[model samples]
Target: MTLHRFAFPTAIHFGAGARKGVADHLRQAGCRRPLIVTDRALAALPVLAEFRSHLDGLEVAVFDGVFGNPTASQVMAGAQAFKQHRADSLIGFGGGAALDVAKVVGVMAVHEGHVLEYVWDHPQVRPIVHPLPHFVALPTTAGTGSEVGRSSVVSEDDTHVKRIVFSPQLLARAVFADPELTLGLPPAVTAATGMDALTHNVESYLSPAYHPLCDGIALEGTRIAARSLRTAVAEPGDLAARGDMLMASMMGAIAFQKDLGAVHACAHALGAVCDLHHGLANALMIDTVLAWNFEAVPHKFDELAHVCGLAGGGQAFVPWLRQLKADIGISGGLAQRGVRREQLPRLVELALADICHQTNPRPCTAADFERFFEAAL
Candidate 1:
């Protein structure tokens, strides 16, 4: 029998058209004026109007200033927009970046100071001990599961240093996970994002932690991804496959309360230093990290192989990961993605500084990251 110490606090309603009830849920949360925080690209889509249709009397405000790898400035602007609209709640509607900004925006709206003040880092700041606006997360994509996460990743605009602001206060009051919205995603985006979910599942499982509860969820999440991610990529119209991936993505977020590993460390650094897509960076780096990680936790690889439905244990995992990426049309190393060779040093520096990687199965020194980058290169 398996058990869990953590319970996902967000009320979840999962189905094909679950997003249609967002307004009712907001009302249940006692929110009147709601701000929908999303990205500019999504704001232009017809879906935006449909999302607002259900909120007829809510006096909805649209703040579409979210950006890729959400910047600190974007969070500030969103907070300003929320206050300007006198919004009572927030609807995080889009991909990971949009959801992350919404979480931070919810925090900033009621806080006394700067958005950066709450970051989970040194020059230590006060913990977020206050209540936040009621928030509803509606993910348009199947990856990033940011809708269910309790933290937001924001970057310093110029330096591109990623910082996480964590608080149970940031968790959405409700999550409307509707895979129907992902039916029109481009194949490449689907593939990349699916890999991000896989990385999350795998890393959380492998992270050196004692949470058997989280370990169980991580393994199950991987199984879900293994069964459905490729199908979702090949047949974007397959709602069932999309739903599985979305569930796996959300499970990854929940399970990763156990924390992530080196793949994320590398991906975050790559995103900050190279401005790469979060999913794509994780996709490209996963195999390299896995290969390095296998020796340290060989038994975990066996467990992963069984859960991921691979025929062979241990020895087969890394190769399968590479093959899976290739099958999804993701090939080559970091160099292929226009990441200059000279950037490796900077990426390593960023990776070492990333707090998220601290729980990696094997303690990673800066040298380990350099070698990891070299392998990817």
Candidate 2:
């Protein structure tokens, strides 16, 4: 086994009411005026009211323009808001989309060029400019672990392509993982996002990487999702289950730095073109992708099956996964979720372009991607 260096920079605070520490963390980071980036749905939540009251005497502006699958224009607009308010820091205050946009805003605030110019497209790219003010992430959902991740997903409005902006410096300086904030997630969102977390764990575990640490983390993360996701979805206010899912979500992100595979590649393409829920798209493709790749690395799936506590070795995983999905009320394939067969050609092309495809256990061509889509559909 080759030696690998692991370094995660974000300082994380986890537990119930962990969000209460945000103000103190901001002060410790020397952020007087911070821009809170969130979406309309989260902006109206009463949980944010406490943060607002905490900042009553301080300078804090809220930018609620962030939308699902954030766009480059939204990041530019957020940058403008950051500058206009003379904000000294950023607080990502919602789910993946909000956190991703906040991270991009932090990048663009210090960089001069158009936001898309900085996006690393698989090959080489210029180094990021000076890091923006300290970023504090407070997740209101238990998925997308964007708070601790270095890459931000943004959509190009014209092409409608979801592009990833990669930079180690984009990770939040501090993160608040308060499961209490996730108690209000709708059942559908809960099931979909939790499945997204499960995909991250399973795919990372299957990725052809040399990081045993990530493999172990992914295994445990998968276990947590399997055990807790359904409970969290069924009983939204169950703090213990919610906390487990939140930790699993963060673990999935950390583990996937080793790599993600066909599931994410398919989801990214479907999300860009069809505007389907990213997590749901991933959930639909995961089993099919797993079936395709299981033969390539049967031992890994065997291990995953063991961790998920199944009796059969590798083959048990898919049935367990399907059962989990059904238990959580995640029923339906990509076609049922609005993905069309006619769009397969374009979707296949876009899925090929996704960087995640490179890490798949089984290397896939455009034709392979088409087959995967057809199977999922």
Candidate 3:
């Protein structure tokens, strides 16, 4: 078994109608006026309507400018909105992009400097110094697990490279994980996001870091996603399935702070290079990267197979993942998703530079990344 230190960072309020008490929770946290950070797409969806109804007339300002892969400019804009509204806190409400922007917004609100100056692996990066505005997250999607995480992935405007901004202070003060908010998700969103949760679990477990608690949570998260994702995708209205996937997503998020592996490196590159949906990109590249990594850590795959209910052991997990994605309608590899053959060099460069791959069970070289990308294609 692996060994490491662990801590539960986010206070969680879970169950049906959980979003109803957002105002009370915010008030208790000393937030009288919070800027609700979300995407333009979800500003007035039925889920947001229900959330507003739960607030029972407590007024809140909203910045709904975040759309798909949040950029540094969006975070800066959200911070400006937070200041303009005289908002004392932030509520990250919507999908991963919204939540990501919200987290960084809270950082930018209190700290002086450009958001990129605090990016995780950047040279010339500055340290966070101020206490952030209180933040509460109510995730509308079960994927990305950004609600419980301490990091946000933001794309750079000029290069479009995805940079992870990490700080323990970015963790939400509380999370209202209501599965009811997820019921309205379309089938494609549901499938892709669920698979993202699965990738987190599998990659975290396979990472060469020693974190037994994370390993345990990773296995259970994998189990939850395997059993619940298909049901949630097919029946969209199944609260039980939705809730399980939600829990699994949260678990994956917490577990992966021990860090991820080649899959995420590749996924991050795909997002940067192609502007593809993060989860869908993970769904496409997961099998290819993990297969490349299988020879180095076969035992982890064997354990993964056992947890996911596959008949075969280590060798079976990759095929099972590939089929699982196919069965749920996540189509094709990198090329099918619009990555050109000529772009392989850039993708490989991005993937190799990504710090996420440092803990990969197998050291990924440029040649290996080319083969993996080729295999994915």
TM-score of each: 0.97, 0.97, 0.97
Full-model lDDT, candidate 1: 0.89
Q: How many residue pairs clash in each candidate?
A: 0, 0, 0
What lDDT score belongs to each candidate, Candidate 1 first?
0.89, 0.88, 0.89
- Candidate 1 lDDT over 1-377, as tens digits, reads 65545666678999999998987777876889999999999999988888788787688889999867899999999999999999999999999999999999988888878778788784868677678888999998877899999989999888988888988888888899999888878999999989988888899999887787778889999999998988998888999999999999998988898999989999999998889999999999998888888989999999999987788788898998888888888999889888887998899899998877899888899999999988888
Instruction: Please list the Cα RMSD from the true structure of every candidate, rounded to 1 decimal place.
Output: 2.0, 1.5, 1.6
lDDT of 3: 0.89
Looking at candidate 1, the ten consecutive residues that score lowest on lDDT are 1-10
Which pairs of residues have clashing backbones in candidate 3?
A: none
After best superposition, candidate 3 residue 198: deviation in angstroms? 0.3
The residue pairs found clashing in candidate 2 are: none
Q: Per-residue lDDT of 182-301 in model 3, one digit per residue for the tens? A: 999999999999988988988899987888889899999999999999899999999999999999999999899879998899889888998988889889889888888888988888
**Residue pairs in clash, model 1:** none
lDDT of 3 at 37: 96
Model 1 off-target regions past 4 Å? 1-5
TM accuracy, model 2: 0.97
Cα lDDT for residue 2, model 3? 45
